[model samples]
Target: MRSASAADFNATRFIARLRSRGLTWVLAIAVVLLQYPLWLGEGGWLRVREGAQKIDIQLALNQRLEVRNASLLAEINDLKQGRDAIEERARNDLGMVAPDEWFVRVVPAQSVQSGKTNE
Candidate 1:
């Protein structure tokens, strides 16, 4: 009967130790589950990094557009202030020739083979 009581005491102590270890394991799992969202969830580090990359791309595009806008503004000012610039653009872009001026074009001749021209 004494040996039986000692066996019971030993079993109880083992069960108590097992319960403590189980609680620790459960707490560790809970901590990991809670932290999962902080690193990989929506609006997390990866999302913020992607947002920053998009912002950088937009800023670079905006800078390029700003430069183009400045160039267009300068061209506008030139067109408004100078007749020479307007005349140059008209002559180049519209192929406008002055009075009494003749336009000429020169094209390369195609090779002839077997008495027929290769167009």
Candidate 2:
């Protein structure tokens, strides 16, 4: 057995000291193993964060769609309940006129002269 001397650096003693702290190394390895799934594995913190962001985007899109659907429903209700709405839509979309109304088309003088010249 070699006696411990203050001036002597011992590799055997250093290795024994490391072996004495074996429990600490085991606990550190266990911590790393447990943390692996929390940070990098499936359904981990990163995956949960990404899923939350997707849900937020989908919720925003649903809100916008709901608003659009509500506006469409209101327009449908207006068209169903009011003849004025129907008449306005017909006039704007189909260019319909009342039976008593006369339709007049105005042509520019330059266009008329250009047509005559082309002919």
- What root-mean-square deviation over C-alphas does model 2 reach? 5.9
Per-candidate TM-scores read 0.76, 0.69
Candidate 1 Cα errors over 4 Å, as ranges: 106-119
Clashes of each: 0, 0
Please write out the lDDT profile of model 1 over residues 7-117, one tens digit for every residue: 999999999999999999999999999988888999788889999999999999999999999999999999999999998999888989889889885444443334545
Q: Residues 1-62, candidate 2: write the lDDT tens digits.
A: 66567325587678778987997899999999999999999989999999999999999999
Each model's C-alpha lDDT?
A: 0.89, 0.89
Tell me how far the alpha carbon of residue 75 in candidate 1 is from the true structure, in angstroms, after superposition: 0.8
